[model samples]
Target: MKQLVKFTTGIILLLTASINGFSQDLHFSQFFNSPLTTNPANTGFIPDGNYRLGVNYRDQWSSIPVPYKTMSAFGDAQLFRDQLTYGWVGIGAVILRDVAGAGNLTSTKGYASIAYHQLMGNSSLLSLGFNAGSANKRVDVTKLVFGDQWNGKFFDAQVPTAEPMASSSANYFDLQVGMNYAYFPTDDIYINAGASVQHVNMPRETFYDGDNRVPRRYIGFLNASLKMSDKVILNPGAYYTRQAHTSQTMFGMNAAYNLSGDGNQQAYGGIYYRTNDAAMFMVGYQLSSVKLMFSYDATTSSLSAANSSRGAYEIGIIYTGLYKNRAFSDAIRSTFCPSF
Candidate 1:
């Protein structure tokens, strides 16, 4: 039974990689927390603070013999806030790592991003940004068993598998560009929309000797924040992305309730649905300058049968703060953005 499970898992991984021509890019169910990965234009688009830092972790397919794990860390800050008369520059960096399957196929990526945000009157803002990164993927070929290795009754490691074995690693450079627009009708209401394109350079990524290039991924998102009262705020958002022949769409709403009345403490809860995929439940809390969030994905697709609906779980931690010398009132007075 153990051998069968491992074999089945290996086959599934092989099929998925073959279909995509490479391993699928790592993503988090709490897409909103990983802003830099979602859109380069979000770099330093901080509304509530001058600078922000965050980290995220995800574990998937725990029911399988070998699970997939992913983690990321990122930080961004607004620059030239006092130097630029009409616009300010934002800079940020992010690092991501992922490992999958018994073969230990691992991927690591790092990116540096920058964006310029211009105030359009007192109610609107516009941003344009880009990022450059390096991606590397490696797998332990020795640990993987090919179909030809099967010896009828049981797989024999001693038997030679005549596969077109290439190098066990691949590396490439990646690029992305994005734009954002925001409108704040009043302090109580804010709306934002953005679109981005990943793999703008169509970098080649392959382990074999053939010429295969990563396809461009297009993403668009819209979100809004409405402050219903001093004690409550509502946030609703939608995200869509397409890469090659596959696409995904997700929509959800989360609300924050002020527990301290002074906005220093709050509680958050929400639900999100991924079309034909999974339903995500989220809960979070905020204290002063830090926020912690947790989410779980319950599989709704056919794959649920194998895993018994045990999908994935994720955790996110974010911190936002102003410079020690900077006055809170001054920061609020300089921008016309909504507070969440």
Candidate 2:
């Protein structure tokens, strides 16, 4: 476990050194479940509902001794439930944490989202949204020993390595903005498109100082849901992101089919491909108001050379509640609404 942590930590630092910026962020294969991270416009944007709460977790690089772990929990509430024509106001909050490597390099983030959704038509809605958050990163430098600390023929933990650092921890405020268009032409046909800019504040994040900070992340995504029949639904989506000189594009679809005659139970599966990254597979089952999903990714990029195609594993859980207004219909609904 110790060796694995050291190796991954070194890899991240080396990558950032090459880019000349303390860069790179965490993500998951199960993107759909991570509504806030994907787009702030999704805040409280639940169709046929007034509130929603969900959580997601990921464990990656288990092929190694020390694995990376991430988890998040979020909640959303939409107001103006009775007046469909006047539109609605949605608000949400999310908190997340990630830990990796032996240094226990940890990142903690909390964000609030606010959006104004204007009713465009009986079945369409347009939303403008914004998100504000604080991100804190911390590391125990003592856990790592640089080569400079090594003697001529051996390594000594007591030796002092001549390295300069401003601090072992950093905290920064981040801002993000987004817009989305959702069209529910019919109960069976639903589509949405959105764009967002994350880290708009560009707060400094380097432990060594200077202007190096969180770079603005630009993202664009589109998704559609088609109910092919009473028993089956097809969902397709594409996502694109750019930051600094690095960019990633992912595209895929999931097909869900009712397993029971009443359409209350479903079994679904899908595959997604991340350009130059890895291929991901997801499988899930929905029972009433609760849905649980699992996804895994295998490296398809050059990084596979060392890890032998090993990648990440993720899990997600979601629950949605129905609102009094029936202006928009959700293709599927979960019966479990927990009040905790």
Candidate 3:
């Protein structure tokens, strides 16, 4: 039994590494709320925030036997800020976990980040940021089926599988850096853009004794908000990422309605199209500093035949407000650029 467990674990680990080396990282439909995962520069960025906290959950590919599940939690704080004078400094920490596959492969990651912002104009700024972390991956072999168990059209546990295994788990250090720019032309307009490079050091990530490095990933994104009237606002954005030979692109727009013309209590809905993959529908509500969001994907690709177009469902919640900085009266009303 021990030998069988080791053999199955080895094969699962090998496959996981091969897939991870080329595919982009796990993603969330409400990517905007999970700021730190997208870019380090997003940490502690709110209009005039003292601190921000967020939690996210995702359930993907329910059509399959074993679904992919993820959960994340993070917090960020403003270490220093200077109205429109000397820019600012911020710091944050994040932890997330994901589990998938018939073998129940699991991954856990934790990271800390810091960023510095430089004033560009009266209403514009540029930010540079860095993060360091560790990722650990493991697998359970009890649920796996071995091909060698098949003998003359029937499975036989007495037969020797003869599979060799080196290890069943591994951990690797990870690093990323990013740059972001934001411009608030008026009370009604906001524009922001950024780029990031992940796995820059390409540390070893294989479970086996051999050396295998995590591939480098490049990401780019932009977002904007336009106020059309006292009750209506428009938000549009796009995000693109590439890892080794695999790439993904997603674009969409959101229509938001202000309930009392103050822009504090709001509701929004949108459709996002994933290139050659699926169309995602999202809806959310925001009251003052708290937001609750939900989304579901309608598969449109070749996989639709197997799953009847049902994909993933996701949920996100966040809270952002001032815990300090009581000096500036207008600070809370400031229009700042968050990664969202």
Candidate 4:
């Protein structure tokens, strides 16, 4: 336990140190792992035969800088079943880009996973999942320029110039393990809790010096949904993430209300605040089988003074597919769908 604490502390320090130097690090969407882009455990959280498709876009500090933009699209569905317990498998990918005053970088990661769910009780399930993937990080050196005052100085060698600058890319494998516990006593109420660790082996980041490895990360989340009436449901969720010496926590609540007489459509609104990060507001809508979500963040930290009210924006979508009818759906349905 002491070793673990020490390790965790070291990682958090590194993360904070890095962030302080850059003024801002690559910002993950405020929703973070909820959309399944950051955690493997979420890959097959929805019922069998149900598919999840989502996209998130964020533009930060639009007022004080060129704006840091990040976007990700991911889709996952369960596949296969086991005799004693239900089993699921899924795959997804995400791409992120960052542009700052003197540097521009882009990264993409792809993942595939298999999960096993066991019935813990009459109304609860415990799932264990494993994910494997590769990430590519690249930087554009030519787009960088340094002051001429550094001419003939050692620092000049480290500085990049405008001649189509130099560029470097690195590919590294990533692994994540996660577990989730969910219980539903009634269709109208449910609770979910989960934890996941990313960058299992601490993949080396060749994009920087010393082949610095990306530090491992630990994330935990809890979400609950309560049906208030035939037309409305309230969902509250909390997320905590730690990397290097820094920790971030987000807490928020959202309400989804059914629209239309048939209940085939719905709309949701919510707000969230990340510790020392940003305050955000979001809305979403579901039309037939497609669900779309959007969010905007407001900077509240000291940096806000320089950046203004401009914050971040995110958009996501989810599509539900009928499993019993489609061939691929039928295959997975027969394997993972619970009989009970």
Best by TM-score: 1
Please give the distance, in angstroms, between residue 272's alpha carbon in candidate 1 and its true position after superposition. 0.4
| Clashing pairs counted in every model | 0, 4, 0, 10
Q: Please write out the lDDT profile of model 1 over residues 308-335, one tens digit for every residue.
A: 6778999999999886665332323454
Q: Can you write out model 2's per-residue Cα lDDT over 130-249, one digit (the tens) per residue?
A: 999899999889887778878898767789987777889999898999999987766677888999999888889977756677889898898888888878889899999888878889
Model 1 residue runs over 4 Å out of place are 1-23, 325-337
Query: Which candidate should be chosen as best, given lDDT against the real structure?
Result: 1
How high is the CA lDDT of each candidate model? Answer: 0.86, 0.79, 0.78, 0.65
- lDDT per residue, candidate 3, 1-340, as tens digits? 8656544554454455446543457778777778888888877665536788999999987765557899999999876564434567779999989998777878899999998877666678788998999999887755555679788787666666654546678798999999988888677788889899889998787656677787888888888888788887788999988888887899998878887667689898988988987899999998888888899999887555555677889999999887644443343334463222
Residue 125: error of model 1 in Å? 0.7
Model 4, residue 318: distance off in Å is 1.3
What is the per-residue lDDT of model 4 for residues 1-340, given as tens digits with 9 covering 90 to 100? 8656544553454344346542222445455433464467777667524566666666765654245567666777756533244344544444444444335666676677766666554567788887888778777655544554267643464554544222378788988888888777666667888898888888887644555777778888888888787788788888888777677888999887888746578888999988786888988888887778888888776555444555767776667665665333332233222111
Give, for candidate 1, the lowest lDDT window spanning 10 residues: 326-335
Give the lDDT of residue 262 in candidate 1. 87
For each of the candidates, the C-alpha root-mean-square deviation to the true structure, in angstroms, is 2.7, 4.8, 5.7, 8.8
- Inter-residue clash pairs, candidate 3: none
Per-residue lDDT of 209 in model 1: 89
Angstrom error of the Cα, residue 255, model 4: value is 0.2
Per-residue lDDT, model 3, residue 208, is 63
